[model samples]
Target: MLKTAILVSAMGAGLMVATVASAADAALGQKTFETTCVACHGAKGVSVVPIYPNLAGQKEQYLVEQLKAFHDGTRVNPIMQPMAAALSDADIANVAAYLSSLKPE
Candidate 1:
């Protein structure tokens, strides 16, 4: 029983760490956007160009999926593919979180 209790505690701790590691940091996302995405996506995710889709207030999961697709070559866009190629999974999550958190204009 004592061993079982210890095992459960260890499992809980591990799960917590995993959750924290996977959680997106919106602050980091904003910085990345400013440096990498602001040119096309805009500061608050509203695109100034009619051709660029506005990202503000979009569903976080959808953004993540699309970004992943772009990164993986499943989605083809000459511009997006190259831009997304540099983003890691965590960066993608962060960017999605930041964009989704915005209120669209």
Candidate 2:
């Protein structure tokens, strides 16, 4: 009983942290998307190009990892490489939150 309660509490705390982080970064993400990402990714994460994957409905952690890779030049998208390299960790996280929340088309 005690263990279960502790586990539940920990999970709840983690969710709270994630929500707070997402909320704080959501606005910044919208701005970044308008300037940098929308050209390829499209508004609300729906991509017009078949080669460009839809980011909506992707796991948040997966999105974050991919963004980090792009920023570090580990992932090679011709147009994205330089832009990703310029993004801060907060930008990546916030953008992930905003995009991931969109419904996949």
Candidate 3:
């Protein structure tokens, strides 16, 4: 019984560590946006060109899935494929969070 409790506690702590390790930091995301995405998708995730989609006010999960698609090569856009390739999963999440947090202008 005591061993079961100890094992459960250890598992819970491991899960917590994994969760924190995977968490995204939006501050880092802002830098990433300026460096990589702001050209096509503007500073606030709006696109000046009609061909480009505006990302401001997009849902976080939707943005994450789109990034995943690009990263996985499931979606094919020359710019996005390369950009996504360079991003880690946390980067994708952070960027998604940043975009979603923005108000549409």
Best by TM-score: 1
Q: How many backbone clashes does candidate 1 have?
A: 0
**What are the TM-scores, per candidate, against the unseen true structure?**
0.79, 0.73, 0.76
How does candidate 3 fare on TM-score?
A: 0.76
Worst-scoring 10-residue span by lDDT in model 1: 15-24
Per-residue lDDT of 73 in model 3:
98
lDDT, each prediction? 0.92, 0.81, 0.87
Candidate 2 lDDT over residue span 1-105, tens digit each: 999999999999999977766564767777887788887887788889888778876777788889889889889888778888988888888888777777898
What is the TM-score ranking, best to worst?
1, 3, 2
On a 0 to 1 TM-score scale, where does candidate 2 land against the true structure? 0.73
Which rank order by lDDT, best down to worst? 1, 3, 2
lDDT of 3 by residue, 1-105 (tens): 999999999999999855754576777878888888999998789999888899999987788889999999999999789989999888888888788889998
Model 3: how far is 58 from its true place, Å?
0.6
In model 3, the Cα lDDT at residue 92 comes to: 88
Which model scores highest in lDDT?
1
CA RMSD, predictions in order: 4.7, 4.0, 4.2
